[model samples]
Target chain A: MNNNEKDKKSLIDDYKLHITILFISTISLGIGTINIPLINGFNLVLLPIMYSLFLAVLFYIYKPAKWINKSQSKTCAEILLILISPLIVKLAIASGENIDILFNVGPALLLKELGTVGTVIIGLPIALLLGFKREAIGMTSSICREPQLAVLIDKYGFDSDEVKGFFVVYLIGIVLGTIFISILTNILCYLVPLHPYSYALASGIGSTSMNVAAVSSLIALYPALSDKLLALSGLSNMISVVFSIYVYIFISLPLTEKLYEKFHKYFN
Target chain B: MEIDLSFKMVSEWIGILLIFSVMAAIGNYVGYQYPFVESLIGMFILCLISLVGLIVEKLLPFDNIPAIIYISLIGLFVALPWFPLADLIIYYTSKVDLISLTTVLLAYAGVAMGKDLGSFKKVGLRGIIVTFAVIFGTYLGSAVIAHIALAYTGMI
Candidate 1:
């Protein structure tokens, strides 16, 4: 094969590896979260600690070289631990306790009391971890392939000047995308007499790959919709798997192509 | 609380174990050749056999109650631990789902983490902005289509 073709193939392979890792990490995060014991003498903090340790070990084992590099390793490890923390908290219920028993109080009252904690304990960490991991992977992979990408990134310096622009654009896209999709699904489910919250939970579970946590949260909030929530969770996951593939192919590919072209022109 | 065991319980356990072991053996053998196809084939075979049994029962014009009972018994035999052999079989065969799912998810997670954020950064906000836009747009588009289709089919 020609050098250009070989280079392209290698890039694609690298991208595939990234995609695979993301899928596994997300799934593991979800599964681990679901299995954590929230009650029965177990506290939520342990979940995060365990998850963080797991993440540290995972990164250390998978990319030993990164661990030796100090800064990158720290950032990578922190990002993974943070992203997986919420899921771990959510999974604490997987100790086989009846979730319904924990929320005997009415839905609104329960949500008011637990929602904030859940957000902090389960949501923020996951978001940060996901964002950080995505950034770290993206930056490192680019740096390896094209030193110029690294120089450009370093010049911008993450939050200032040039780098800020990219972050802003990417964040805007992700926020807008997540909101739009979440809202649209919520509305459509509402129109069909299906629970909007269940739909939201399902979408969240599917996209984020946090199955048990999302479903359990919904079940806690709406006990009446437990069966539907479970079914939707499964359905959404299957759909998400397909959607993720399409997203990788249709979105990542075209974007990568354009980036390479632009880099060639400006950096080279 | 101590649990009591009867002859029936022992028999069922033994049966389940036997079935599980056989399934596991077959599964492992196939898995060695094509790991990805393991669970898919197992699920497919189970479904297919069930379907055929149902069809045959219909063709024979069997009494509904008796047929239901027969199927229930068969299902119990397949699922229960009636024999010591059942435990061995189940232990080996029943892990296909877990293995395949874990493998696929792990592979995907690794790759997603490996994405190049520099490109997104290079294009500035535009790249990041577009990524979210496309993801949301696709999701919305699919939801709308699903909603319309469901509405048309009166599934809702």
Candidate 2:
């Protein structure tokens, strides 16, 4: 995976397929932009990202035309980071313009990260209760997004139970996390009555799609607060992107290991 | 040997980013009603910053830091008030909506997922249940804390 041999080969051979994927993505952008108006002036904002994603999936899974092969999909996964760079840049620029938003949010930005501990506090216990072994630590220590998965794989080789556990949650995150978070964000926004800023901060749970979904929902609800919300969410996500690994390694992983020793017995 | 590989890699990245900017600009115009030319220009500048960040990541002795950090910092630096092109950068970039870029990223993500459907189907019910717990715990937990923190800070 580290070597660029496969990447280079795909770049050369599958250049046409890559363009086709981009073409399909453009169509998705058009369809995804549709927003249906519901009662009480609320818009049922259909997720454009969802459509693009599902379309790509259909192209892959449809038997008649196997549009993308394993190598090509692998290539797409590798370039995911590169594709995300522009969005990250956009977020950073948002943060720069609203530097005062950072100051205004103050310790909330730092303290809200503590909420990540909720992953272990809630997820680990349930995972253990469900009879997972050391795997619970891998699954629950963090959200197990790409970066956390990389860290876990480094600590425990890819063959380990921990990694198996990591992949379980990771795949679920990739497949369903965005949809779940978007729905949850909207429900919370409607029911909780919390400030849009808090929702924006919550949206930065260290995964790109999940974070994007959360913030998109917030912006849909609070168009007037779009800039500040984007700024806060971007900064919060940047904090997660930069610091999530250290938190997982130094704080979450170690603490989960300790708690596992004590909690595993009870679950059994 | 490494330098040659990286050079080739940069060109490939440019190709990919070019595809994203051009398509995303069209999407921005169609979906959000942003000006196509302005959005295209904005996306190109973003691609340039990302390229610079990738180069910096390769040049650095330490490998721990991700390119996103450098890319974001470069983005932030140029957007700072005193920077010469801050306004221009801010103006065009504002035309390129964040959500529009996400549609492209996730589309690729979905394509990547298609290859893994066989393995994805094998995940056990326990794992699925716990996946929900992890996602919910992280999001709602953070939201609750942010709620309290915001009230205390009087920002709400």
Candidate 3:
């Protein structure tokens, strides 16, 4: 390949690495957000924003040359920031109290709480729906990029009729799965007396990132359960990550390929 | 007086939609390229949407005031009914939360996106059937495994 082409490829690789790092950071923040106290009703919503902003700042400052550069500087910087931001915010509040600023801010707390409730109820779902759809589109685009997977999709011979059929089956599977898991978790919770928070944690194992959001929001609303929720979520997240890896490597891809070969004629 | 829906809300929603779409598209692509990134990508997409909503609200016209109002409303709705639904099911049944359910749904999406039917190939029917089967089977397997584990440990 020409030098220009090589340079372009390298740049793309770097971009991919940055994207991956950003992706992982977002997931981690989601995990962290679940445990944040819901003082004045702040929870998953604000916590993630705080964490992501920290990440963005770090990204901007370090501007790592490679994706996997394990520089302690960046890690230390992040740790310091996470520790400091809350302390600063808390200190400010304390100082405000001494100066009588607390009184002025105190009433605003009610407004903030009301506002939080409103946003959580009305805005989050719309965001989630749009988010999921967008993620779906993102998934589609990503799939198109993979030669092997793309070839497999093309071989499946997607058509309007087939797409509709697939959509139906897909929806059915989702509904059934949801019902089944819900029942199963319910039974477990009843017998074990697992807290609702614990149930959320376990449920999160299937999808770490999504679960992080669920767990964080729950923690934010109910700070009393924060520690237990965090522990459970952490455990569940580890298990989910392991399981996800296993499924992807051993089951999902191979079975998909095999099935594709076996049933190609049926789809057409 | 009724509060007007500010440009911030509209922008936030649109930003959310765009981010989500990007995430979804990226996820689909990444799953095809590296299946391992599936759940990670899925979560990232969700986070990006939320972030977009939060950021755009700050940057755009509605400012923090209307944005906060919009977000708080959304958060409450999601947490309230959804949490209870999961709780109610767990209250009476042996199952847990909806993780497995969502996973199966995602897996189906992954599979549908992953498959490649040759020209003149009949993937439509087969893909549908297989996707359903896979989702159901995975859900059942996960639930059984979780239930059995909990039972064995005397947790359930």
Candidate 4:
């Protein structure tokens, strides 16, 4: 390669990742802005995404070296979630008088056989069919998230055999689940005929970061449903947290074992 | 990574405080109810509570409790109208603008994914497929049940 060409390629090699991130964020922000109208004689609607897009460019350009690792990214994500936690609090507090919604919403979420419970019911059979071993079944069925880990440790002690699979799934959930859930839910919104409330409820799959990402996209599509969606998501999340303890103790743990005994042979 | 109990850490903290101050000042012009001065105080309170929550979370005899839930539950109670300074907290937090939060967050997520491309590739095609398959089944199960209930209740 010529000297000038070599210099250009070297610069690209040095900073390609940041450039790629900036490009992706910019394109996504641009695509998201397509149908935005000039609300109040100005495009105020695009401001948030634009600001976010700007932050992306600025951060990529500056490159926060401290935040380049997996753990640091997770910490930053936790901090961001903390900043956004008030939304949940506000929604819960706003829906305080209408505690009826909790009664009304709780059954739908719990009964649907989804969330953590449904994760096992639906995912176990499929994972088994896919030749998944019993070792991974514990992790595969449940969300294998933070709360589950805590419960697992408390119930069986940290040294229990189940803890091994939970840790693997937990790692996968952190690294892949956090990002994929957002993208997947958005795609599901388009695929399913259900209302945004259902999507919001689904968003509350017991992971705060994923829930935020899912609800954000859903809200973008149906801005009018923001409050209801947020309320349902928050309430559902609260229910998940409060009841997940019982669900695991009574349902998920046993079911995983039963399903494994019944199906692990088929996989082999 | 052991955080040094030294002047450097102190200096870093001071720098972060200043950045939040500037961000809040700019937030005033960009959004509603997020007053420049109020935002500074608001962010300070958020950081303080989060720090406390982290300590409490670490001391708790459990694993895998994300600090977000700890702080959110606590923040929820603190945000009740009956709580002192609740109105001020609402005024500041309500202006956080979810869209803005999402944009910045998802952007971070996107970049994190980009940075982790090597590891993702290592997980190979099977990992990606299983992840999607699990997610798909979960959504289908949830949506199917939620749809029936909503239909029965006529909330659809």
Chain B TM-score by candidate, in order shown: 0.29, 0.84, 0.26, 0.59
- Which pairs of residues have clashing backbones in candidate 2? none
* Tens-digit lDDT track of model 1 for A237-256: 43333223223223432343
Better of 2 and 3 by DockQ: 2
lDDT of all predictions: 0.33, 0.76, 0.33, 0.52
Give residue A72's error in model 4 in angstroms. 8.4
Give the candidates in order of TM-score, highest first: 2, 4, 1, 3
Pairs in clash, predicted candidate 4? none
Which candidate achieves the best DockQ against the true structure? Answer: 2
DockQ, all models: 0.04, 0.46, 0.03, 0.25
> What's each prediction's clash count?
65, 0, 76, 0
The candidate that wins on TM-score is 2
Model 2 residue A34 distance off true place after TM-score fit, in angstroms: 4.8
Which sections of candidate 3 miss by over 4 Å?
A1-201, A206-209, A213-230, B1-141
Q: What is the lDDT of residue B13 in candidate 1?
A: 30
Report the poorest 10 consecutive residues by lDDT, candidate 1 chain B: B102-111
TM-score of 2: 0.72
- Candidate 2 lDDT, tens digit per residue, A137-251? 8999998875565556545644457866886887677667867777777787778877888889988987766777778878888999999999899889866765565577678
TM-score, first chain, each model: 0.32, 0.63, 0.30, 0.57
